[model samples]
Target: MSNMNVIVEKLLAIDGALAAAIVDSNSGMILGSGGSGVDLELAAAGNTEVVRAKTKTMKSLGLKDNIEDILITLGKQYHILRPIDKQDGLFIYAVLDKSKANLALARRKVLDAEQALVM
Candidate 1:
C-alpha cells in the first residue's frame, strides 16, 4: 500500500493535473493533497456535496451499483472524482487541463491509484 503523500504524488504525475485531494465525503474534509493550480481545500467541501447528492439520487432511483467515477468537464479543464471501491466515504479528486490530457488514460490512472491508496 502507498502512503497518502505518495498517492497524491502519483496523481500529480498525470498530464495537466492541476491539483489532487483525498476527500472524506462524510465530513467534506481534505485528508491529503498535492499540486497548486486550484484551491483543493475549497473544492473538497463543494465536491463533497456533489458526491453526496449523487449518492442520494442513486439511492432514490434504486440504482444498485457503485460509481466508478464522476466527471465534470469545463471549457479549460476536467474535474474527476474517483471513490474507492473498498473504502466508503473517501475519494480522490483530480483536475486536469482538458487540452493536455488523455481522458481515457487519466481515468485509468485514477482507478489504478485508487486501488493502491492507503486509507
Candidate 2:
C-alpha cells in the first residue's frame, strides 16, 4: 500500500480532478488532501455523514456486502466516496468536473487509489 500523499497525488492526476482527500470518517476530518476549486474541508465533513448514513441503511437492509464506493452525480460534477478497504473508519473523497471527466475511468482511478491507500 502507498502513503496518503501518494494516493492523493494519483487521484489528482485523474482527468478533470478538482479535489481529493483522505478523510477520517469517525471525526469527519481531512488527513491528507490536494487540488483546489472546491471547499474540500467542508466536503470532507459533509461526506462523512453520507458514508455513515449509507452504512446504516445497508445494515438495516441486512446486506452482507461492503460498499465499493458511493457515486454522487451532480449537474456539474461527480463526487466519489470510496471506503479504504485496508483501513477501517477511513475513506477517499474525490471531486471531478463532469463535462471533462470520464466517469468510468474516474471511478476506476478512485478504486485504484482506495486499494493503494495506507492509513
Candidate 3:
C-alpha cells in the first residue's frame, strides 16, 4: 500500500495535474498535499462543504449509494474529489488543467491511487 506522500506524488505525475491533496471531510482539514497552481488549503475546506452537501442531498433523496467521485469542470481546470473507500471522512482531491488533462485517464488513475492508499 502507498502512504500519503506517495499518493500525492503519484497524482502529481499525471499529465496536467496542478495540485493534489488528501482532505478530512469531517473537519475540512488537509492531511497531505503536493503540487502547485491552486491553493490547496482553501480548496480542501471548500470541497469539504461540497462533499457534505452532496451526501446530505443523497440521504434526503433516499439514495442507497455511495459517491464514486465529484467532478467540477471549469473553463480552465478540472477538479476531482474522490472519497476514500477504506477511510470514511477522508478523500482525494486533484486539480488538472482542462486543456491538457485527459478526464477519463485521470479518473482511472485517481481510482487506482485510492485503492493503493494506506491511511
The C-alpha lDDT values of all candidates are 0.92, 0.93, 0.95
- RMSD for all candidates, in order, please: 1.1, 1.3, 1.1
Top TM-score hit? 3
TM values, all candidates: 0.96, 0.96, 0.97
Name the best candidate (by lDDT). 3
Tens digit of per-residue lDDT, candidate 3, span 5-109: 999998998889999999999999999999999989999999999999999999999999999999999999999999998999999999999999999999999
Better of 1 and 2 by lDDT: 2
Q: Provide the clashing-pair count of each candidate structure.
A: 0, 0, 0
**In candidate 1, residue 76 scores what lDDT?**
94
Off by over 4 Å in 3: none
Tens digits of per-residue lDDT for model 1, 28-64: 9998899888888899999999999999999999999
Q: Report the alpha-carbon TM-score of model 1 versus the true structure.
A: 0.96
